[model samples]
Target: MPEPKEIGHQIKFPNTLMGLFKKGWWEIPEIMASSCLGLLGIGLGFIAVLNYVKNDGDNREYKKVYMIMRPDDPRVPRLKNPVYTQYKG
Candidate 1:
């Protein structure tokens, strides 16, 4: 994997956006277009995470046996029925 410095160094690229924009009027629209693409990526990533959480079923809790005893035991009647409850991922 890339080192932290190598990964984070790209943050400085945007620092030159203003300087690059001032270099020519034609570049303004290109810069805006590139920024829009970056925003689109961020929005898509957010939506994907939201959808994953909403549809995820494996992370939920479900009823399961916690104890067992002979069927003829008098305490069998006290055995509580297991139930399920909603779980948010």
Candidate 2:
């Protein structure tokens, strides 16, 4: 019987959106277009991530924060912060 083939690094390339957009994928026009789109996408993604991390979006308490302030609220919820609030979803 033939020996089973090795499964070494069968995946040769990244399949994610950003990963697929990496350099050397396109030939010319596609490369040109992707260059612009890819860079913008990367930049925007970075900004989004930065904004998320910067505003404590990953915090446990941040998720449970109230959307709207109640009358005579005693404390500030992370939801009170506009930038981080949108990232809840």
Q: Which candidate tops lDDT?
A: 2
**Residue by residue across 13-75, what tens digits does model 2's lDDT show?**
467776565534543567668778999999999999999988777645456554554545554
TM-score of 2: 0.36
Residue range with the least summed lDDT across 10 consecutive positions in model 1: 6-15
Tens digit of lDDT per residue, candidate 1, span 1-89? 97655553332224376766655444477877788899999999999889977765233234363544566777555445534455699
Segments in model 1 whose C-alpha atoms lie over 4 Å from true places: 1-27, 57-89
Candidate 2 stretches with Cα past 4 Å from truth are 1-27, 61-89
Candidate 2, residue 73: Cα displacement in angstroms equals: 18
Top candidate (TM-score) = 2
Candidate 1 lDDT for residue 17: 68
